[model samples]
Target: MRLDQMSGAKLEQDGSSWQAYAEQPLTFQFSFGDLQTNQDKIAVFVRSVENGQPEAWVQASDGEYQLTLAQPGHYTFEFKARDQAFNYSPVTAVDVTAIPVPAMISVPLLGEVEVRIFQLLVLFGSLAIFGFGYVSFEIVQHRRRIVAAVERGYNPYISGEPVRRVDMFFGRHDLLRRIVSTLHNNSIMIHGERRIGKTTLLYQLANALQEVEDEEFWFVSVYIDLEGTTEEEFFHLLMDEIAQTVRELPELAPEQIEILNGLLNLHLAENQYTDREFNRDLRQIIHILEEYGAVQHRGCQVRLILLMDEMDTLSRFNHLIQQQLRRIFMRDFAATLGAVVAGIEISKEWERVESPWFNLFNEIAMAPFSTDEAIQLLTEPVRGYYMFEPDALDFIVEHSDGRPYRLQQYALEAVNQMLHHKRRVITLADVLVAHELIQLSGQQPKGSWGEDAARGELGVPQTPAPAT
Candidate 1:
């Protein structure tokens, strides 16, 4: 089959591009000629000039196709003709480019027209939803298809689920990198309320450490959920988990694993198996780990990171436990043994008992997602399957305010709303509807200003985080 006409043909493979309006839909028409009349169908591929990811593509017999590429970036297109005999012929191979030309395309700010307009609207104090289209059935069906496609393609946004899998987790790249770097040399206190993604951040720390490169010390992470855990339980769990973590670490000799296990079991076999014995041997184990890294395989040294999550449980532990932790982190083997403590108020817990060991950690204040990171958290989970209109995405970011749980939950609801309206793309109006529904369901955040803030609220103050 041969092509009839290509839209935006000024787009050239030589890096030249056609300046198409952002959000403009490009259409191409194809027809079967006498020579290719026996063709079963023709396949079309569209790719972004920036990342080479497709904007849209489909196999069709002979017809017109359209896709609204709202992202303002360089894009390329290709067309292929496949015959009934399965023979393929090229119509265009990376031939055309579409570049979006918007008034504020050069703005350092993110999102698109919606964000720009919303900023302006905020200044004018008129953020009310002036007009919105009625939800259409086609939009709902389209949105459902996208939601289902997302579930099949990548990890779907599950409410209350910590992003254990790396792919499901989005954004926080810079934060994760920073935490990992800090963990290499020092321990950190992750300060944030529960459900703000502290657990996932800790998991991501483990995930990043799992791919440790040679020469860098391999941090054997022992994740300890300290919520409701007593001091005795902590001792038992820490020893049990060290055995488990050894197995998960990289480049451990059979002797190395046995040595670690034997060390832990030997301490447990103490006549009393008391906290005193647990503390002493745990330090010995930390020293052994440090030595292993310095001597064994020319890979990561035996550094270990204790992911002490829900650190609030320390409130229930006695000063002995605190003293033990202090000596362990500060005196025993600070160089090789790192810890990441996650909790609502790390300082508050430390204040319950004055401990200089708390001073050893560089505090990492876990704040809400930033705008750009929020965009990735919103889009990456559903990449390639569906898209959020600039305004819709901005609206969600504004309402959710970088709290990952709210963002995912609201985005999921918006998808449901889109599916209910048979829409493939989420719009500002859709976000508003979802916002209202969430508010009605009693899930809206407390302390939010009423309708004025709800409609066109601008710059609601976020909770101030303590300085690190």
Candidate 2:
């Protein structure tokens, strides 16, 4: 008997069993050299003593052999080689064993129930269709409904339309570092010009916080436009979001959910809620989140991150709301959670409120993109959409001053105009034409127009560039 081209074989001394690590097919090479002279047959089978089970015997050719393990266990492989003359060799025993790993033994009853109710139902329903051979037909019908609903209800901003993030030359690393480190310190303020991508940065930061994964930290990102929102509406929106998130999470307990909902509603209903309601709610949310950090053996340390965008429009409470928020932010919940509040010149505007919390917040301003960053943003689009001349991007970047909002706006408009005109290349002339058309329509102001005045006329905030 000879073994040829043997690979991936594991051997251990002082043990009857040999081990190989695999969950799939197992193959090996074995040959009888003189078998060419006579007809022969060989049988291979794996017998398990612990289970007292034997696999179906497999026939082997003279040159090579293959076998597969259907289950994991300790087994002895037997080989019987017989020649055409009815000669047989003694049974050759090869021991095989599969290794196992430790797993969590306890399952919480509530979680088990949820899994059975949601996951098992969906899985078993799909399995039944598959078993009946109607899987493809059912999938087609279900997929059509999904596609139709998505087409009907699609809204870019609400749906989180994909925005290709461009790595700016003066990266946001320093600002991000300060914001993350401030998780230990308290709240931080993001005050900048309009369209400077404050909301974008906030979303990006939320993504970054996923790295922390420590249970102690919970990140709840809330974007309240404050447009057409009353104090009741705002409170309800916040509460609804928090409640739904808690309910959806499988890891949290029903008691914790009840505690959180009770605390939030208590503060809201008692009219004990003042401007300090935001502060008080924030404190409670953080406290509840901290409880998620503690397990029996290990305490997961995490930060509760609150990212709020468009702080200026939260004026439903009259001018008094702003003043109350400023005071509450300055005093009440300064030591608890990390917050990023975004608005245009908010710190300056809030200073009149005389709230020291306004003073305590670590203020960072976002500057407009540098010329290079603007050019990169412009050029990066060319590979995806080829309506523009290579030189057109440079021209757009020059005119836009590396402002992301304006860059995208101008680029999108320019491409539309070029396609409308049936032109092959978008030139500087095309951008100039679009500019004239946009200016003529009073969509954008002409030369020397005041940014704030233009923003007010357009009903859009002027976002500043991101600060390095």
The candidate scoring highest on lDDT is: 1
| Candidate 2, residue 415: how far the Cα is off, in Å | 1.1
Candidate 1 global CA lDDT score? 0.64
lDDT of 2 by residue, 322-365 (tens): 55555554556444445677878677765654543446567787
Where does model 1 exceed 4 Å of error? 1-155, 214-216, 250-257, 260-272, 279-296, 351-353, 444-468
- Find the candidate with the highest TM-score and give its number: 1
Q: Give the TM-score of candidate 1.
A: 0.57
Model 1: per-residue Cα lDDT at residue 272: 46
TM-score of each: 0.57, 0.50
Segments in model 2 whose C-alpha atoms lie over 4 Å from true places:
1-178, 213-221, 227-250, 260-284, 295-298, 313-333, 351-353, 382-390, 421-425, 444-468
Separately for all candidates shown, the number of backbone clashes (residues 3 or more apart, or on different chains) is: 13, 15
